[model samples]
Target: MRETLPILRLLSLALLAGVSLLSSVALAQEEDGLDIGEAPVIIPADPADAGTLQPSPSNPAGATPEVDGDALELDRRVRDSQPPVMKGGKISPDGEADQGINIYLRMGTPLPELPPERPFADEPDDAYGAFQRGLFLTAVDKAMPRAQLGDPAAQTLLAEIMSRGLGVKRDPKGAAFWYGQAAQGGDPAGMFKYALILMEGQVVERDKKKADDYMRRAAEAGNASAQFNWAQILVSENPGVRGLTMAMPFYEKAAEQGIADAQYALAQVYSALKDVPKEKKDRAREWMHRAARAGFDTAQLDMGLWLVNGYNGPRDYELGFRWLSIAAKRGNVVAQNRLAHLYINALGTSPNPVEAAKWYVLSRRAGLKDVGLEDFYLGLTEEQQKQAIDQANRFRRG
Candidate 1:
């Protein structure tokens, strides 16, 4: 509701299918409200026999939507791979924190800056080798000498180790200092880390101008995270298509480097920008599909709807249904709600009153309240309603 006029003027999801119009959502929610839409108008199977769910005559039973070879390959890829771009510090499937970044952080005041260099000789397997093998303390010891000698790489290693607290106490202040040093010495990693620290203003004095400089430098140096984040920052600084246009190249570069978030951004860019070339607009399909396969649940939700409604190309209800089912299983509440619609309408698979109600129940449990689904559930027979409830209760998100 607080969105700017420029964002409101941009293309909305309504252009895709039955989705409502919404301005370009902000990035803070991590793509929330970017793809999901309300349920389409539900045409009863037969007005005369409203109790039974049936496909509308226009959709036709046994509608054999053509199978796409590219889609088949995409299915194979998404089905086979684990999530491609897990952020550091997030818990994994097994609920263990990613030892990658979080393990290194200990929330405390920064240690005092190191004294002048001691006579410690460096080795081929110096700080980096030890750090890679999880020897955080040793890495710090080895890196200190070279860092004091103004080696950017060694400074970067110390910064990372100190920031992550890799087998050592987290020294945010020390990390900030080393990160700043490494950035000054032209290390991309240091630039990106230091830029973030500067932005946060907690670990050091807040310096937005310096943060932007380091972020831009790191992005130009081809750090994928830096590229995606820099694009987001650009969009934030200059809203609307003008901002998006300026950010496109960086988004593309990041996407090409396998950043799922960037791929999703490009998909939005092409879809929302009306003046884009036909070929470029068409790339939206590829980008959306790629992002979905990379475990971006929002992309997966949109790809399903796009395929279902032929927004990208031919309507393939079956493929859309499969994708929606996948996202629903992955605990996307919007996907769950839409999957319920698919079940009731028999868009992709055979309809079961129980399934439609069950999906609605699951989505409702997640706090995605849908009045349409409420009515649909209310209309079910009591016996069927009980079955739906049982199924919903038994179901667990995969």
Candidate 2:
């Protein structure tokens, strides 16, 4: 046995890796090391087992002996509404993503007053619009004249053309100068683009602080993308640090404005905050569905899992399978594996061995080789395996 110990360790390592890969298929639940076969087991807490309830703090003298049903309901409500706090995508119920930043802000005795508002650029001749519509060379010729006249839009557009070598020579410093001119003129889009360039520090000098300030300004002006990006910088994934809670409000505002990515993030936040009130589940589902409908792949996969698991709503396998199929087709490995599980287990919908096999092959192609390949291979007949191989070969050619 001692001589064979090394071989056993290697086998154990391989098994652990395989299980980890397979576990990625299912929605993570407490105590059940992630399996496609099970749902979350909600254990109800019985008042009788909980012992005598304390009297309400409001009326301490005259107390009903029975459990405080109102208090119980209130606690339950809170559990339902709370959003899952996350930082850098780690799962934590609390929103503690930016602990360091929060501490720094707290330690600082004084906060500076915001800088003066930047002014908007004067509208250029319709040439910028024509350029945006892809009439490049024509717009460039027209924009050059307006740029010389100090039209901020023309300057910015001219900069864009020059930077991309679009109907003109690629000029880095020249582009930076124009971008700076437009940004100083208070164009929100120009500010965002300028901030990006400054952050990269290629064409212009690196200025992290200035970049953050510019992003904040653009976000304050209700730029949805800017809000999302700025919020992302505030969150952290490490445990004990503040998570998405710091970014939640911004994400919510952006989501309300119909930003698909923001909506998706909001949904994920709610999903992670399991301690939140159940009422918030409806809102989470709404945001997730909206993002999924907009072709957001991550949201599609999440919503599909929710449908499969009956989280925050009813369990509808047909709908679940439909959405999962869509996500799988779009190359989400998790979705592919989940789809395979559904097909093999006949979960939520009727099973089709052939469809299951196809998805399994696709999952393998996506670099997810777990129970998906093993299960599908077990389900297929020899002829079906041949057909799958033939289809895969044909797909490779195309």
C-alpha lDDT of residue 354 in model 2? 68
Which structure among the candidates has the greatest lDDT?
Answer: 1
Compute the lDDT for candidate 2.
Answer: 0.58
Candidate 2 lDDT by residue in tens digits, 42-159: 1111101111111111111222222222211111111113335656445544556745445657897565687998895643356755665556666666766655555556656766
TM-score of candidate 2 on Cα atoms, chains taken together: 0.63
Reference-based TM-score, model 1 = 0.69
Q: List the residue pairs that clash in candidate 1.
A: 104-164, 104-165, 105-164
lDDT for each candidate structure: 0.66, 0.58
Estimate, for each residue in 1-398, the C-alpha lDDT of model 1 and write its tens digit.
01011221122221221111211221112222123343332211110100111111111122222322221111111111233334673667775557755434554545457699777463354567666555556666777666666677776777666666556556677777777877877777678778878877896898989988998998898767677667767776666667788888888988897777678778877867767789888898899899889777777877787777666566688899999999889888788898998888888899888999999999898788888889999999999999999999988877
RMSD of each: 21.3, 25.1
